[model samples]
Target: MVHQIRPRNSASASMASRKISSMLPSLMRQVIVAFIVGVLAACASRAPAPAPGAPAAQEPAPVRLGPLGGPLAVPGTLSQYRSHWVPVAWEELPGWQDDALHEAWEAWLRNCERPAPAFAPLCPEARRLSIASEEEQRAWMQERLRPYRIESADGNANGLLTSYFEPELQAARVRGDGYEVPLYAPPPGLPARQPWYTREQIETRPEVQAQLAARVIAWVRDPIEALVLHIQGTGRLRVQEADGSTRLVRVAFAGTNNQPYQSVGKWLLERGLVRDATWPGISAWAQANPDRVQEMLWANPRYVFFREEPLDALAADAGPRGAQGVPLTPGRSIAVDRSSIPYGTPVWLASDGPSAHLARLVMAQDTGSAIVGAVRADYFAGSGEAAGELAGRLKQNLRLWALWPRQ
Candidate 1:
């Protein structure tokens, strides 16, 4: 945003003028200035007068300033599948000055690891500026990038914001001690890009169960937790191995059944079985109707399988790998409509609702089936129960601005 530094206040200017006048005391100097002024006035009067019908001289046009007092830039256009970019001043972005950009620098660094073609050339400078002061970083951005307001093809700028998070659950390497619900890796001989089996079929059909038995990576106590993990696509498991040792591991998304996803809570609501559809509400309903929990789960035909990865100390702190193949930075990574905002693009996100009041820099590092509109985004709230609570309740208004290189 253009932040013009206004001239000094009239009172301050007047005071400074008086102070300078006091410094110039010699009457001879005053006489010399008066003589010079008289000569200039006489010269102007003696100059040839304009002829009749001659054009008068005009004042120069005012200069327009851009962000940080730079020359105003010509707006540029960029096209996408479901959205279009319209150039906007950096000042147009909501809360642009309020955000702590240094907090987002880590995520930007991650984006550099697998940057989009347009951003690759800027990485070295970005890395060098990592430790720079916020003002310096802001100045660098103003000099190098342009902000574009993202809008729908038909010109709508408003969109919905929802959230998702990585689930963390207690589990076991074996199927005993109430840890009966098994999470699987992709089934052997599972056909690619084709419908395999529905959730119900996978659970009920003996042959299908037989094939999946050897694929169970870990077993959790609650079927609902397993379902949550499936819907979330990745999670951390604190597992008790048969050797009586405990270890933390990540189960990242591997593949999903080709069948369409159905929302279990929506199914319950349609059937008049529950009043609220949030995850906590769904869990409450399950607890109240334990006998029908399996039936509720089968409402969603789609299932996601996972591949296990070891989580060392450093890996444990980082989020799951996103579509961009970088570990997401909590509160600074988002899943967007890839067609609208390409992977690795930096975005200015602003949203206000019961769950969060956010105006920050976030990287478009992931995508989801439900995230398919110009302004729509699925915020990654990080891992564990606290993040899950926020994700479950976040459904609000959203606006986005993409930061692109000027060149």
Candidate 2:
């Protein structure tokens, strides 16, 4: 949702300024332990095994003893999971200063403040954000911020800002939490473009101007929390259609070699798909192909790989042999942020698939080009002849959490 459309004359300078502004919060120190635990829980629950020629869905298999019990013992402590933090501008804080926006944010924060809550335990560290000295705050900001700059296809620059969030913050309000916070509906008669300023009306829109001012104030005064980052990857999926059709859909950046058959950009260019190509194309293609989707996945090399067992028993069985002749198992693998969650941490992932209830400790052995940012992960199904049939057919939303050292 980038709103700044104007181009900047200098790109590097904009990035440098943005980098300095997006600082990590001191509160991050308090949540490290909990954040690490969350990552491990997610890795422990990998995707369940797929039934022969079945469409992938979210389900866990009955727990079974594998040769390797859980995530392999590693040298580093969870403390090592701490890495650089980045600052993010609060450009789109939803209901900025509007009564609705204020209520939503405050309610969310209050729920976070509760003790032993379902969400990450809120600490005084976050509450104490206002006391820092300017120098201290600037120093902290410099240490953790990563500049997010926009560069157009023509190499022209766009507006820049210091915006980023800590990688570990997780906050959400769910049903039955018992707090009974009502949802905020949009204000009556709100314009279609409540905040976005058109070139012609930028000078005349008093509400828009006030909204922007309020956003800046919130950015300056609010205590920092987790950051949201984007992850991009290239892969192929085998989509199955209800009509018993199947298709191999390539997914990647538009110019990449493995672009999905119905990629959004391509579809837009071909006028077969609308503006948001990748997601829409994949969805549309799946609707068109159903029965042979699994088979099509088995045929593609881009979507299959091995998920390392949390503790590589075969590797450990080799007893210091170090990745030698370890028997690899055929299973799905996912890439996760090593910083928020360590690599090789065991996770429990629940998906809608045949592999439901299948439990296995996972090794964070690999990363994909698109698998970056906190709370982000990538899953890999096995490879070679054994995996050929079950690879790309996986298309399911997953709920992930980790299992690790008791807090």
Candidate 3:
């Protein structure tokens, strides 16, 4: 989670100082490849029949193909409190026609599953648009949904849009095979609001470990992997059971220790140990200062526990269910603060800044502690390592428009 909240006075300056994750593009591509292979393997047993006239050997492509090409832009209007929809024409939304609306249709339908009163009216229209032309769909949306730009009451139009993803990891049912670190369920009697054992105590304290003696959901080798799974709040675990067979399962967020969350990147930067506070930078620093690994992990006292969820072909095909009780659509789902934009709202998001540029339709199906304010959003990029790298690096000025049902 990003520690720095946007200060009111220097919104632009605050973003400028934020370090983009330094993971190499080639490495990110490789991570995506690994993730694709894993997905295919999980789906191999339940292969779907090819559609008529489709390539016989072709498999379904993963959601969200790659990194942002460059800057995405179009004419947009900004104003204080609220921006008038009257002056904003459909033509103002950049790349509206280019985006594969069908790809986001699943997310829209997911919204309808727990439909907000306002979106309920548009449900029938959204379903039939799968076969419609992009232009036709655009016109349909214009009639069905109204878009209004948002700014903070203090008049800040520029907000932050970062991203998040589910990580995939190899794990074990038993403590053998170098998989020593155990992810636990909340130990019995840990108070909901009280801070439990810190990360350090979880590591070193015998008494604390006793409470979790048999509470190993799965065992992962790297402490870093454990920390990452904890941070992402959900992940796919390729667990090998003692029977010498393996099946994949999701380790989902259960509860937190109520301790303060701190960014490991910030820890390195504060000590003048690194210039760029990204994953690669952190890994490089760890390599150099191997002894300080414990110290770094201790910086954040918060500990997250997990519960094992059985994964099937369908569950494996899609992402973990978000707080909205629906599977998240990789590119189109965003986590937002409920107070500003209610869950199930469709939002038009665009950004053009020194670091990144994007424009797309997203569903506000999830929320995070760090995701606050009228205009802020956390874009769900995709799953696995590449997605996480992009999520960490994504700190850019954002423009937003909430697409509410037309009156």
TM-score of each: 0.79, 0.25, 0.77
Clashing pairs in 3: none
Compute the lDDT for candidate 1.
0.69
**Cα lDDT for residue 317, model 1?**
71
True-vs-predicted CA distance for residue 218, candidate 2, Å: 58
- Give the 10-residue window scoring lowest on summed lDDT in candidate 1: 1-10
How many pairs in model 2 have backbone atoms within 3 A of each other, for residues 3 or more apart or on separate chains, i.e. clashes? Answer: 62
Give the lDDT of residue 199 in candidate 3.
70
Q: Write the per-residue lDDT of candidate 1 for residues 1-407, one digit (tens) a residue.
A: 00000000000000001112222223322321121111110000011244578566333223333332222332322332446666776766777776899999999999999988888889999999999988888899877887877777677777877777776878899877766778889888778799888888887889988999899898876555565676677889999999999999998877777776665556777997766554345545655776666676676677777799999997777888888888898899998877778889899988876557888899999887667788888888888767766665566788888887875
Per-residue lDDT over 1-407 for candidate 3, one digit per residue giving the tens place of the 0 to 100 score: 22112110000000001112221244653342222111110000111243478544322222211121100121111211122222143444555556777677788989988887667778888878867777787788877765655556555556767666777878898886566667888788878887777777776788988998877687876666666567667778988989989988987877776777676656777999877654446556766776666677677677777788888987676777776777888889988766666678888777764435567788988877767877688787667776765655566667776776644
Each model's total of backbone clashes? 2, 62, 0
**Model 1 TM-score (2 dp):** 0.79
lDDT leader: 1
lDDT of 3 at 251: 78
Q: Which residue segments of model 1 deviate by more than 4 Å?
A: 1-80, 276-288
What residue runs in model 2 are displaced by over 4 Å at the alpha carbon?
1-76, 80-329, 353-358, 384-389, 405-407
Q: lDDT-based ranking, best first?
A: 1, 3, 2
